[model samples]
Target: MSMATTATTVSLTSVTLEVADLQAAHHFHTAFGVDPHIRLRASEAHSTGFRGFTLALTVAQPTTVDSFLGAASDAGATVLMPAAKSLWGYGGVLQAPDGTIWKIATSAKKDTGPPTREIDAIVLLLGVEDVKASKRFYVGQGLTVARSFGGKYAEFASGESSPVKLALYKRRGLAKDLGVPAEGTGSHRIILGSTAGSFADPDGFAWEAATSLAPTPSTESAAA
Candidate 1:
């Protein structure tokens, strides 16, 4: 008998949120399959802050996108943008109770694939003070740039086969783009998974290297 060894790829699974109501926040994120950490802070006001980031969830179908948006609103997430048809596909945005923003979409021109959760995958869109510097920093961390435009935006393609996508955006620009106030303060209260040692991004978004001892499944997907 012959044995085959498959390689395991890295992904940024969940982004943490520091909220005043941990229980409520957890309930809200449960819709996204995220298990938030229970935390206590020195200042009650400091317990919650805008982390200057938005999550992008991609689904396999337009119907799924619609369903997810409805679910988001029902789960207490405010719809920043309603699901609609666009050049890209059917998509929209949501603002979670804990202040996290999500832009979700499905391919408009392509056929919807397998059925999964309303949010099948996530893209971490970090709003940075400086886009160019942030892009350079991630490149230094061994991440390859999938695409970029002048100093305005850049997407860091994941190394994992089905990895969580990441991107950089101007802080105020992002806030304004999302129809929200352009302000970020206090602790980010978020955790990002990274193959690189745990460290803060140029914008203070933190990342922790993969440390789980569980065996990687042979058919495990990076997108999931």
Candidate 2:
């Protein structure tokens, strides 16, 4: 893991969701952790079916994949797909009550007997109408391409100490992957934060570029 980064470097820290119910959305996401590193943008507009994007949570072990989903289920999250051993790895999908989709998986190739209940990382996958265009746009924005496949998917490796992994996917295919209808998602409901300056992707996911603020001294008292 990398050390904490200063405000000088513009980092994509959080992925914001335009949620209809503020309290419900906050409650559901906060369950991931006291800090899943996300921000929720409240909204009144109602959107149903697919939102054309999904958040991926990477776990450290195969058993941990199941454990995360198990805990998620216990927390009132709807299980889109139960955790099972898959060709790629042990993984499954889930949907928050607010309609945001999440895919959880572990890179651990073999099934380790027990689960650890951990979410090691979160990657935001945006579904774009044109994969090539999206790829070109991010690369043009000074983001290096970490990996690409058949022009359908692309992942950019962020050098920030704790960064939200960024990636892109084919719009319709992504909806299919999340098992949601390919319609009725009005605005994609995504808000990306970065130092790269505010802009929207070709698919309409918004990015808010933040100016780094100086670090401040702690106000708490020292105690033994």
Candidate 3:
């Protein structure tokens, strides 16, 4: 029996940050030109445009670097780098809270410059059991389906051309191609922006959908 092969083209879905204190993190981010928009929630704030991914600050007690590594290991999160003291100061590695290897760091660098250029897009790739069904559901939700490859894959443009794109694919093939071990059904997950609730795809792939607010202008000049 020939196993079906899925294409290997994975786009970034979302990036999230978890901080110890929402207020303090918000203030620090603001100092770096990353202004957080206040919504109805007190502990949550988000950025505007492609500039902001998602920021979450919870009341987790500070753990030693070793403890943090242990927690990540227990959570099945891959450790990109072991925690260690660095020239920049502080120490942390890159690891996803749940398997994905996102960069986790404790930066000691001082804020010496303005914010970088805004992001151009946020890409979302979903791994699904049934691509046809997922496509149908998205279409039913009034989203325009742009590009599709048979019943195996589909892509949708947010219609704004703001660089945010959503796509769905078969789970096993997706995981295989991405080199991510299969973790059962609905392995895809998403982290939606502040307003919209985050969700996981049929294959457990994570995703988040949210309208971005405009950013506040800064008086500081860009860093060299």
Candidate 4:
């Protein structure tokens, strides 16, 4: 491909959630069955209200959605939205004990088989002030645009080996979708692991090269 058409080769490798209490965060992830998909780091950054982002668990069907949500609740996640059918799909929202908001959802309204505690994909959606500007910033960092809807939303294409997919959405609309207010302050309390070098985006989301040092829990026991 020519330089003009060449897409950057960057891809996401890990997602680290900064939390005040690491042990509690680990326990929560363990209970929610997503410990393998995320890493936890110690942070005391002052933050309040919406954190300008959310992590979503895309599952196969409604039954699976309910199963995950139930596990999250039993693990100490606060329900933000009860699981329900929508025009787009069935899903629910919750806030983890460590203050990270998560949404469990599926496009299939009905179950095709018995329920399973399986997550189809994990998407990190950054609620940004300007989707267009953020999209440009990410593209500059070597992430290829997968699907974009003008200024409203943009999804990036991650390598098949990527542990997580990244996307951008207008802050207000995202807040509404996640059932929260659009206002927040202080650090994002999250770090992205990527092949791209370390830098903060236009909205202050941090990314560090995946090779950076840090010991995290093993993914051996978790479902992929």
lDDT top scorer: 4
lDDT of the candidates, in the order given: 0.65, 0.70, 0.41, 0.86
TM accuracy, model 2:
0.82
Candidate 4: lDDT over CA atoms?
Answer: 0.86
Candidate 3: stretches off by over 4 Å? 1-121, 161-163, 184-210, 213-224
Better of 1 and 3 by lDDT: 1
lDDT tens digits, residue span 77-152, model 2: 8998787776777788998777778899886788656666566778888888888899888766666788999679
Candidate 4 lDDT, 1-224, residue by residue in tens: 12234445776778888888888899999999888778888888899989999999999999999899999999999999999999999999999999999999999978999999988899999999999999988887788899999999999988866778999999999999999999999989888887776889999999876743233463211121
Please, what is the TM-score per model? 0.73, 0.82, 0.41, 0.91
For 47-105, candidate 3 gives per-residue lDDT tens digits of 21121111211111223334445554554455555655566444344333322332223
Q: What CA RMSD would candidate 1 show?
A: 8.0
lDDT of 1 by residue, 1-224 (tens): 11113233334543344456666765666665433221112213353445688777788887777767777788999898888787877888888877677787888555557445645666777889899999887776666788999789998766544335778889888887677777667767555665565778777787765442232211111222
Q: Pick the candidate with the highest TM-score.
A: 4
Clashes of each: 2, 0, 20, 0
Better of 1 and 4 by TM-score: 4
Model 4 segments more than 4 A misplaced: 1-8, 212-224
- Tell me the deviation in Å of residue 69 in model 4: 0.6
The root-mean-square deviation over C-alpha atoms between each candidate and the true structure, in angstroms, is 8.0, 7.2, 14.6, 4.8
Worst 10 residues of 1 by lDDT: 213-222
